[model samples]
Target: MSSTQHTDTLKNVRTISTLLYWVCAIAIIFQILVVPLVWYAPGWVEASTSQMTVSLADLHALSGWQKYVTMAVMMIPSLVLAYGLYRLRKMFGAFAHNAIFQPEPIRHLKAFGIALLAQTLIKPLTGAATSVLATFHRPAGERVLSIGLSNAEASTLFLGGLIIVIAWVLGEAARIDDENRSFV
Candidate 1:
């Protein structure tokens, strides 16, 4: 592509990077506030107490420690997502600087992909952990444990795989570009 194309592409990437930066910042802040929100404003959460159906009120009604445990359970995936978003923001930043073929963006892409895959793998664990934690104070007969798979998890894994493949392709392209330069 020509220099003008590079400049235009970089400009678009910069715009997208700016948007992603704000989104990640806001998401991080929201994730951090989840505990406080759950503690102070339980209305924001929707959970039921039937073990099969738990509402935010059910979680809110738990003892303080139990609530904290539940919060921790919920925070794990959110934190991972935040970290992924942060990596993606960095990747976009590099792209904005016309660093598409450099190692930095490739590394960021790989990290983000791994992070997403990690989240996909841990989702069931988190759910089980949360269920166990939520029932920490419950009577023996009232306790419950559950785990399952969902389309969202499958989608996440697919996206992660796609990202890793894209990174690999880019890396190969960078190698080819270097080889072509040698011939010049």
Candidate 2:
């Protein structure tokens, strides 16, 4: 690419990185307020007709700290997702600063990939656990143990693999660049 195109691409990356950084920051901050928000805003938190099989009212059925545990079970993956987005923001920032061949961006990519993989694996387990917890206060007939591998999870797993492969390819390229420098 020409200098102008590269500079424009860097500008675009920097803008996207900034947007993602703010989004991640806000998501992480919002996670801290979930319990209170659920307490005060039941209608907003609980959507009975939504695609979500279990509503906040279902989670509200849990007694004492068990409710918090259920919330944590749900929120933890979101935090992981936020952290992954933050890592991607950092990686994009590195690209914006012309640090493509450096270790830091590669490390960020690897971390983000691992985070995505972890989320993909944990989501089904957490969903089942959350369903069981939500049923804790429900009648026997209403209780359920559910698990499934959705398309979203599959796509995320694929994206995680793609990111890891990209990171490995970049690492190899960096090593080759170093070797070439040595030959000069």
Candidate 3:
């Protein structure tokens, strides 16, 4: 192939690379801003005669701006992810109807892997954050966000690393396949 062809292919790959980074970054940022609020917001539980138990549902019943704001934040992760995935899939180059990658309907499958981490962390973060705010003045026992992250949060790093490795393998396979085709 001519130098121009090689340059064009490299340019296409570069665009895909930029897309991968942007999608993942947006997912992480959106999760960061939203999940903590949901996890930490107040809830309701029955109280004993001697002691009191706050119902977690009490937070759900909150009215006016509090309810609306919390709901909006909670939905941010899903909305941002859907939009980013749409863009990333477009950039990744879709599989044809009969392509080996099947489901020409999908894109950014690997990049959306970040959403899995978001699922595991956001709940706990929101719960801890809500508790901290509600009891801001109290003794602050066992601050979930402060003392240490949950086991799930810690595992997410490993999952993200694994996703990266899988992406590398896919890239290497594509490169090898391209090189072999050139000789044919």
Write the residue-wise lDDT of candidate 3 on 1-184 in tens digits: 9999977766766666566646656654654544344435423212311111112443444556665554554455455455545544543544311232322222244554565445445644454444343334335573223223456556775775566466556666666887888999
TM-score of every model versus the real structure: 0.83, 0.80, 0.45
Query: Could you give candidate 2's per-residue lDDT for residues 8-83 as a string of tens digits?
Result: 8878877776676566667656755654576557777655224243666676667787787887786766677667
Q: Report the Cα lDDT for residue 47, model 2.
A: 50
> Which residue runs of candidate 2 sit more than 4 Å off their true CA positions?
1-12, 15-19, 27-40, 45-53
Better by TM-score, candidate 2 or 1: 1
Q: Once superposed on the true structure, which residue ranges of model 1 sit more than 4 Å away at CA?
A: 1-6, 47-53
For each candidate, the alpha-carbon lDDT, in order, equals: 0.75, 0.75, 0.48
Q: Ten-residue segment with the worst summed lDDT in candidate 1?
A: 46-55
lDDT string for model 1 (37-156, tens) is: 756875555352222223455566778778777878867876887788778878877876667789888888988898899977876787787777777677888876767577878998
What is the C-alpha local distance difference test score of candidate 2?
A: 0.75
